[model samples]
Target: MPVRSPLYLLERFDPGVVQLDRELRVIAMNSLARRLLPVEDKQPFEKMVLSFHPERSVAKVKFLLDQAECPVSNPPPMTMIINIPERVLLIKVSKLSDLRGDTTGYTLIFYDITELVSGELPVQPMTPESLSIEKPAPAKRQLHKIPTVSQNRIVLVDVETVTYIRSEGHYTWVSTAQGSSFCNLNISDLAERLDGASFLRIHRSYLANLDFAEQILRDEGRVSLKLRGETTPLPVARTSVSRLLEQLGIGEVDAQRT
Candidate 1:
């Protein structure tokens, strides 16, 4: 994996606004947009909006722009959530027009929602094709590939590569070595769907894969498990600690001795 850019540390809550001419050329941008984007690294003026984005994101941005050209009067803004490096952005595009109804310009607005996602995980950019899976009727089957949402696109992650899963209200955030993505399935539903032999409910909000287990950390009587490729240790509930250790082939006595 490549080193994460320090720019990911910038405040994510602030809104970034950019203005584009009818030709889709960058006209202006707010201070926040300059900081949030690569405006300094790349020339902004006379550059097409697509040029400002990474090659992988260009198609999605173009789609958003295309969707904004609604024939009806007072069309709603086109919205999408996209991943860039270590950040997740919620973007909206609104079209502008002259008095005669001729297209004038556009306003592109975005918010960084990285905190709502997995902390410290670089969000992997997903393609539109990845998001186009047909929804089939629910059935009881072991999950080999889990579907996750990133940039309004669905990404299929292989189950073996997953490190952990965290509950977010009814939805779940699936974590892997690359990054985390939002999964529509609830934790309980996922627990039931996933292979019991591979995943364990270590806590009410956490499901851990024992294959990634690196070490069992005990601090002040509380137990936490450090997973491979993950920086933070997952809290192991008091009740689940022994089970987790046993699953790792570590007896309680052996764990205490270590």
Candidate 2:
């Protein structure tokens, strides 16, 4: 087949295809490439398709292509993003060879895979009935009711009731001035429901209410938090010291004292 006919065929092809040379410079591109690429030049034959993907630079592409030339039964496909001003592209790369069996470079075919990953693709619209059909009815959130100090009533207490919360296996122990109570709630769930300003997670296993904290202590270079009515100091990890101080309205001045 003539070169012109092959070029014409490439133009009509659906997927965007760019042919590169040994130096990874674009030698030719199909009509689909013209539509996909942001290049202003009408003639796609001589245009060097520079590495559009920010993460996948020209150096990285060349390195991968070189690796692909090795004798392997099967090579894993490389997924890369093509950064265009108008849209983001998810690209799949395949090594290309010349007619003389020399490793010329690579061919990249890309499509917009952003919507699929981001869950933006509209399936069936969700209705109240449709949402409830697959699962049991969700229990109503009882935020208005305040639980008394007595343990007689079963109460759904807010995170604010507790001065400090500690994790025990699957359950969390919420401690207050009156007493401590166990709840079958994870630290993550409590963190989401808690008031950000009042409560702060100082450790992976513990969350403390800043309002109830009397003082924050640094014991021998290790940090610990002193909660109201609590005899034992709550362990504060070094990683959480900065965030914990910020939440308590204590800045550099307070940090230096501790």
Candidate 3:
């Protein structure tokens, strides 16, 4: 079978494309990619692909590229959704090969979906009936499984398995005994969707599951929490300490006289 050209596949969608050599250096990119990526001022064509992305995102991009390589012909493209500043991008990576079926390079294509996922689209205004004080507020539904991404696929993590969630800009890192995976939803959104009784906001950046609470470490007025399986302690805000203790059914033991 003949090798399929990256340009041939790129013709189907109006997406940003960045072509890379086997060494992972940028070989070429479409005009759309140059405009969307943060490489306008620098000579980025010959630089490594990882250099163009944020430090936090380098691992994810590397994972995407690694997953794209396959010995089989016409392998499925690896896909991932990532957030950057005000924009969200849906990225896909496919490996390029030579006529002898040897790996030659890679092609990364991305489409912007910020408006679709970030609530930037216009919404309908509430009517008087919808805002009536007579009506009680609807109960927030608890999330059973958090939507997370691993490799090139989306994984649904059971709520009970989650130990904590850390906010990263508009996205989050969902951590469990298995490991941490990227979540597209922000911490605030997860807080609203999770069971209020089980999940507690310990700090601006951390939401911890009370079920996994092992110890509360206090040092010099600063408070942090240790989970059953996790080694590192999660920082607890000064304001949230009292509420955290109360939620754990300990009830401000520090305030009690010895």
Candidate 4:
């Protein structure tokens, strides 16, 4: 009987080993790999990897591996995410080669990263606008110098004087310390005009001035804001809570409350 090579033994021992050909097709997969992927006994491997959404980390790995000066002999491991219906995988890719100074392919090892992606881990808060998932509110005029309003003439008001702004149909109503004014603008448009640090979108219909905000209150995923000069409290959505807390420099407060 012939003795097995150490490399072959190592491949068999690995819990998450996936072998791919030069064409990025899956040539072989280990037991763990089979469990991780949704593959049938007769299905092609390359098709499985390509079915995944183009991920940034994976693209970077491909780029590095394709480089002419790639140090495949001692290729550094790479981390990436692979999205599957049930969960997202956090994968590490390592290069594998033959003994005769010839490149073979890659070995992929990965596990679930659903918790990390879901903000279960400590992560920086990001606005919906930043994600490009939702349109931001329209910008209200800044309140630097008070605007001169005539009895019949319309005037633009400073956004800083406003305690909060609400969306109503085709126009947004800006509420200030003095009074409220109606303007023909959408919330998304308004959000772009105001400074991100000064204004915060708490709810789909509301944007509050953080400088004028007194404090934030949370109850079972619900958030409410207390403005410095306003008697009424503002409601915040659960999705906006983290961003609001981070904007107010009160992330610690939210963490403690949670």
Better of 1 and 4 by lDDT: 1
* Per-residue C-alpha lDDT of model 1 across residues 1-258, encoded as one tens digit per residue: 685542453333456889999999999998777765666568887899998786656766887899899999998887765555444566889999999998999999987644333332453333333223343433444556675767555465788999999998756899998899887556776787678877999999999998888888889999898999999999999999878877788799889876
- Which regions in candidate 3 have their CA more than 4 angstroms from the true location? 1-14, 122-147, 150-240, 243-258
Cα shift from native, residue 204, model 2 (Å)? 0.9
User: What tens digits encode model 3's per-residue C-alpha lDDT throughout 73-146?
Assistant: 89989887654543446688999888988888999988754333332333222334543445786454456767
- Candidate 1 versus truth, CA RMSD in Å, comes to 15.7
Per-candidate TM-scores read 0.48, 0.43, 0.53, 0.41
Clashing pairs in 2: none
Cα shift from native, residue 4, model 2 (Å): 82
Per-candidate clashes, comma-separated: 2, 0, 0, 19
Model 4 over residues 44-140: C-alpha lDDT tens digits? 4665455443443344345433552256566566544333333334455666667885667766665543333232332222323322423463323
Greater-TM-score candidate between 2 and 4: 2
Where is the poorest 10-residue window by lDDT in model 4?
145-154
- How would you encode candidate 2's per-residue C-alpha lDDT over 32-112 as one tens digit per residue? 565555445334355444544333244434444565565643444454432233233445566655576666677777654
TM-score of 2: 0.43
TM-score-superior candidate, 2 or 3: 3
Local lDDT at 153 for model 4: 27
**Ranked by TM-score, top first:** 3, 1, 2, 4
Which residue pairs in candidate 3 have backbone atoms (N, alpha carbon, C) closer than 3 angstroms, thus clashing? none
